[model samples]
Target chain A: MIAADGGLGIVATQRAVLTENGPLVLASGAQLPHVEVAYETYGALSPSRDNAVFVCHALTGDAHAAGWHEGARRPGWWDNLIGPGRAVDTDRYFVIAANLLGGCSGTTGPLSIDPATGRPYGADFPALDMADFVSAHRGLLDHLGVDRLHAAVGGSLGGMQVLEWALQEPDRIDRAVLVAASSRLTTENIAFSAVARAAILEDPDFRDGRYFEHGVTPRHGLKVARMMAHITYVSELSLAEKFGHRRDTAGHDKRLAADFEVEHYLQHQGESFLDRFDALSYLHLTRPMDYFDPFGAHQGVVPSTRFELISFDTDWRFPTAHSVRIRDQLAARGAAVEHAELTSPWGHDSFLLEPDGYHDRVRAFLS
Target chain B: MIAADGGLGIVATQRAVLTENGPLVLASGAQLPHVEVAYETYGALSPSRDNAVFVCHALTGDAHAAGWHEGARRPGWWDNLIGPGRAVDTDRYFVIAANLLGGCSGTTGPLSIDPATGRPYGADFPALDMADFVSAHRGLLDHLGVDRLHAAVGGSLGGMQVLEWALQEPDRIDRAVLVAASSRLTTENIAFSAVARAAILEDPDFRDGRYFEHGVTPRHGLKVARMMAHITYVSELSLAEKFGHRRDTAGHDKRLAADFEVEHYLQHQGESFLDRFDALSYLHLTRPMDYFDPFGAHQGVVPSTRFELISFDTDWRFPTAHSVRIRDQLAARGAAVEHAELTSPWGHDSFLLEPDGYHDRVRAFLS
Candidate 1:
């Protein structure tokens, strides 16, 4: 357990060897010789083992969905919606969040040492599928000895994971919540992710993803990609409200660098991101999202699980239309599904934020 | 005149040294020691000199506004709207199109030599403003010995230039048409440009904007920037209509490169841009647009030039709100102004395309 200052915002990430059977096979037929899952759990497991709830995180997020670390400045990414009495209500339900496959957090990813070569997988890491992420999550569940989950919840990429799992094991999850997710990435969405990947791959320092040998990383490329993604994550209105045309510099310094407040803010976001994220991880994780076509491939295999799909009005990344499409497809597949387009000034990041009627809706549904 | 084959599409670009008295003063209090303007003309000059219309080129455009150059496959940019019988109606009006001050074309830009150092201006190039573009344009007019114009027309950045010139020289232009333009860039807009600029500046080959001296340029950075900008230039609807989620590669290559048709399209845009555009010029030109707050600085000043502002319904970059703001500002200043939002599948690039009800509106206003 993380040493909590006042028994609040304290959580510890734990690890367990999950692949008991011979090499875990991916959706693409590739196999991982060994798999170690990193996960953080909140609250106690019910005596019936039926009160377990799983949480999936978006791109750039880790297993730390809620609670604060021993020396952290702020709570976990989704601390607002998954605490003692929050939407998920840790007091009554056992909640689990794991670092996804191809992630750079505690989970085994591209940065993990290959048992065969005794080296980081890096560029040699096999292609990932949405099903592969679900497979890893199941491994964690099997290790935890949870037969069934009361509910599963995720947003953005996390939501994609939740969707793939719910579809793969319809009988395991009784209820599922997918927020600001997509059944299929649009051409524009694919284009944005492609450019971000290109930025990292084309960086001179990338060195074919073996930058560890050179004691350097593709910091510039990764920073640029982060800055670009940040622009798309937030709505124009939110940015205008936050930064506007306000320049931080006095007079007309007129340098070609960050002069406007928004520029500096983006630069900070980009620079700070370099500390935690690996370029290879960014490429690997975002690629699966580009190719995620659940409804396309699983048209006939419909899930029996009930679903609540949520979207944000200002989310241009994966707007309400994306949820509506998911709803329609699930409805067409003879599945019971509910959808809501919530009002929010934030864009795609609205799921992580407590927008009007957002937390309340999630809370009411989860209960 | 350009030598024409079948007289179908032919035009020649011409050059003139415009500043006769002294060095041209920039809006930022800096001055260029020398100034030369590249211009192209269509239609015969009226004997009364009252039928001249000036066309301003947007970012990455040259003085080649219309007609085909010898051995070129495609006509000059804006060929649809400025031909002999198009919207501007070159047959009835003598049209003059000039490259902007910081452009990479025939006009003096960062690629131009700093007369003092006997080397390319590069990073040493003085700062630019919307007013500086207007000043250089005025010099072009002085050299042509044309005191007044029937109209001044431009779209996007070109539109911004037209608006600045109209305000600076109110009596000189009878009518001004601004298309998909912004008087002031929003924070989101500046953030985009800032990231684009950072890509070039941070590229290993940039060499502090003196990549020319190193016999290398920021090709990767500039290409990335162009690819990013192209995404904004078109609407998501148009991208969907044009490319959809069509995968171009055979089967599941599953590589991190361009898989979707839109990625290849964006890749082509980025690669082709490297052939014609200079990195320094890209930085210089885009910077001015970020700092373009004409209304903020020139609030007391108002133009008598009749204004016709056109915006595309789908232009998210500088949407109809931008044009509405321009109209409201001009109207508040007691100027005759008209605003219209035209339907177009294209986004910001709609101004350059023959969208429905667009050319007709401009032709009517110009005539």
Candidate 2:
């Protein structure tokens, strides 16, 4: 536990291995020994300790799930859903959120030091998958002395982890909630991912993903990739409504010169991401999303699991149809499952936003 | 006159001034003395000359609109629609296809040397508009000794030119056919354009638009831009049908390794573009597209004009609704207009690809 500041305690955790196991071989053939995870906890564990809730974040999110950092204007990314009396209700349940295994945010990732050489893993970091990420989380829970979770909730890649945890450790989770998740990467998804990866690889400054030491990062390349990804994150209708070539009259000159406000927004997003994230981490995490299959090696049906799933109607990236596919699989096996296609214009990001009737549905379902 | 093999003769006009009297100034505050247009003519110009037909091409198209080329597998870009018994019916009407003034395909664009400096214009090239482009075409007609045209026909950006001709130069064109066209750039259109421009602008090798003499070209930027543009050119349904997550079993290993076939396709388009086209010309031509407003200053109403418009039901980029908007605008002004939203899965590119129904409609209109 870290020190408290103001009326709120600023909880932080340093990186540490969850298990003393042999090096796990990665999909890319690299081996990782003693994986470490950085996590934070809030509220108190229930009497049964099964009231522990796990929160997973989307792309670019970290373990910091709530509270203010001195002068921070915003609390945490999921501050709306995880605070006391909020949707997840930390008032009654212990909450845990961790940075993924291959993340740059205080987790054992490409930026972490290699014990064998005392150097940053950089590109040498092994490729990861949803199971590998959850395995690290499992280790973290072991360290916390919590054997089971009341619920696991996530969206986007975070949703993939929730699905994985349900399939890999069925008895450990009482509920699994997935939002805007994909069962497997479609060819178009793979195709777009390839474009993003190529954008980085083609950057001469990328230096074979060793730009960290070169005092130069492929910011432009990363920016391009992020811009591409950002487009997929929102729906066309949302884009039309939010950005709609409505020129920002005050800064209209610069806006028109650059094409439009949306372009400028995307450019800023792409450029800013490079400063905070490692390209290697991006490479490692996205690959797993590309290969994820909850049904495992089975070609016909989803893996048997009792689950609760939700998807947005406008999310073209991971549409409602994908969730329905999983629902059908669970139905085929007669496993308990409840799913819904929420109407929202926010696209894949809708799960995180406050919709008119979304909170009530989540509350009723979780209850 | 140039020799066209097989007893066919083609009259080609080289760099003729289209607008010599008070040439319009570009958006960049640069003034051009005269706009130079390059054009080629096939078949005979009728005695009345009313049989003269102007064929407009889409982005990346050229004056080479028909017949075979040496060592080529396919004919000209529009060979299927402009030949002897085809849509435009070259045997009955003299067809005039010109390379736009701000294009790289043999027209006077940024690739052309500025007489003032004896160097490529690069970023110094004047910013143009649809009006400027139409003015240049008018100059071409005057140079060819033609007073008016039976019809001005085009699709996409070319379709924009056709609409401009009908509205701005009403007396010079008896009829106009715009296929898959928008009167002005939508917010979404400008947004996509911004992504493409950013890809080119952010490339270090772009050298602020002076890449030609730097011994390097921003091929990656150009390719990324093209890849982004390609997504807009095809329909989601078409993408789902043609390239849907189906594994190229033989190429699966390669795809799973670094790049997929789709990646290769995008890279090829990006790199090959630099070999044949001028980057500065791309910037120059597309800039005009942003400013194109057939209606008076983007009032969301099409200008009063005599036109028969055609669009594809599946063309989401410029869908049937876009054509209907034009029709509605024309109706408001009591102008004669006809529109048919053809059914095709080819999306925005249907006008260029689906020649069966497309040619039939054109033939009936022309007759």
- In TM-score terms, candidate 2 sits at 0.91
Docking class of 2: acceptable
* Worst lDDT 10-window in candidate 1 chain B: B1-10
For every candidate, what share of the true interface contacts is present? 0.76, 0.32
DockQ per candidate, 2 decimals: 0.75, 0.41
Tens digits of per-residue lDDT for model 2, A191-283: 677777777777788887778889898777778878888888888888888887655432112222475678778877877787778777777
Model number with the top DockQ: 1
lDDT of 2 by residue, B1-367 (tens): 2234332233334466655666646434467754677777777899888899898877888877776556665667777677677678778889888898789877778767776788887776776777767767777888889998888999888998898777766777877888999876766677667777777787898888788878888877777777667767877677667766544432112222354455566566667776777666667667667656567543443444468889988786787877888788777766789998887887888888863478788888888
What does the TM-score come to for chain B in model 1?
0.96
State in Å the error of residue B280, model 2.
1.8
Residues B1-367 of candidate 1 have per-residue lDDT tens digits of 3234322277889998866789998877898988899999888788899999999988988999888888888888888788666788877898999999888888999999999999989989987888888898889888887889999999999999999888787999999999999998888899999889889999999998888988998988999999999898999899999998888653345767678888889889999999999998898889989988777777777788999999998898998999999999999999999999988999999988888898899999998
TM-scores, each model vs. reference: 0.97, 0.91
Tell me the lDDT of model 1 at B140. Answer: 89
